[model samples]
Target: MIEFHLDGRSGVAPYMQLIQQVRQALRLGLLREGDRLPTIKDVVAKVAINPNTVLKAYRELEYEGLVTARPGVGTFVARTLNEEAGAVEPLRVELRAWLRRAQAAGLDPESIEALFATTFRIQLQESA
Candidate 1:
């Protein structure tokens, strides 16, 4: 089960944030195939979000072939994005250290995110 959180200041739509969180969880191996997602009612209770919003997010995920919804049951992961779950912890530890160093160097969260996004895009382009 995944716990949902909202960042109101993120400038992203709540539903898209939910979808992104699910995708991230899949990538991190936190949600594996056949894992039941939290119920829409559960998400509404936890996040105070509208049920329709949760539905839209789940529908989008279903359309992406990442998950499936069972009527009267719950949504479930259909597949996973984590091909190398074993590699995650080491990379995450390195990322945490890098984040700490970035903070110590006076980079705020937004700045660090911007820097990382830019670098990530550049890396993708270069690799491609």
Candidate 2:
């Protein structure tokens, strides 16, 4: 089973965090087609979030064709976003090196995260 986690201080919305978790799971091969996601009740109970939030996240996944929900059953994984398992390691290594440099430059964890977030947002806007 895939477990959902949230970072309350991450500045991203909860629904978006859930959607990203599903996508990340798909890319990392942690989830496969036909795998049922946690029930909305279960997610709300475990994560202490509103049921509507969970539903919204699931609906977004369905809209993206990454999941399908049965009327009475549950949401199931419908597709994967990645097939290459090794593709993330090089990026992870580069990220680690960047982190090291940031720390050496006297940047704290929060500062580095903020800088990265700002840079990522700009990159996303440019690409779009």
Candidate 3:
């Protein structure tokens, strides 16, 4: 079973967070076909989020063909999405080191996160 974690302060919508987590899990091999997902009731009770938000996220996943809902039971993983095996990991490691350095220099968590986001957005736009 995959447990959902919502970052209410992450500046992302709750449903998108849930949907992204599912994709990340699939890429990491943490979730595979036939795996049962947390029920809507369970998610609401555990995360204190609206049930419809979770349902909407699930619907989006279903539309993506990554999961399917089995009425009377619960949602289940359907397939794995694309995996960029040769990429991302090294950049992630470097980013982590940079984050640590920022922390050591007395930057608080929020400041570091904001700086990273700003830098990422600017870099993305520049590359485009």
- List the global CA lDDT of all models: 0.95, 0.92, 0.92
Task: Give all TM-scores, in the order shown.
Answer: 0.70, 0.73, 0.69
Q: What TM value does model 3 have? A: 0.69
Among residues 3 or more apart in sequence or in different chains, the pairs in candidate 1 whose N, CA or C atoms overlap within 3 Å are none
Q: Provide the RMSD of all predictions against the true structure, rounded to 1 decimal.
A: 3.9, 2.9, 3.6
Instruction: For candidate 2, write residues 1-128 as lDDT tens digits.
Output: 68888899999999999999999889878999889999999998899998999999999999999999998988899888876657778888999999999999999999999999999999999999
What order do candidates take by TM-score, descending? Answer: 2, 1, 3
Which 10 consecutive positions of candidate 3 have the poorest summed lDDT?
80-89
Poorly placed runs, candidate 1 (over 4 Å): 84-116, 119-128
Question: Could you tell me the C-alpha RMSD of candidate 2 in Å?
Answer: 2.9
Model 2 TM: 0.73
TM-score computed on alpha carbons, candidate 1: 0.70
The prediction achieving the highest lDDT against the true structure is: 1
lDDT of 3 by residue, 1-128 (tens): 88999997899999999999999999988998899999999999999999999999999999999999999988999987645756778878998998889999999999998998999899999999
Model 3 ranges off by over 4 Å: 86-128
Per-residue C-alpha lDDT of model 1 across residues 1-128, encoded as one tens digit per residue: 99999999999999999999999999977999999999999999999999999999999999999999899988999999876878988999999999999999999999999999999999999999
Candidate that scores best on TM-score: 2
> After best superposition, candidate 1 residue 124: deviation in angstroms?
8.0
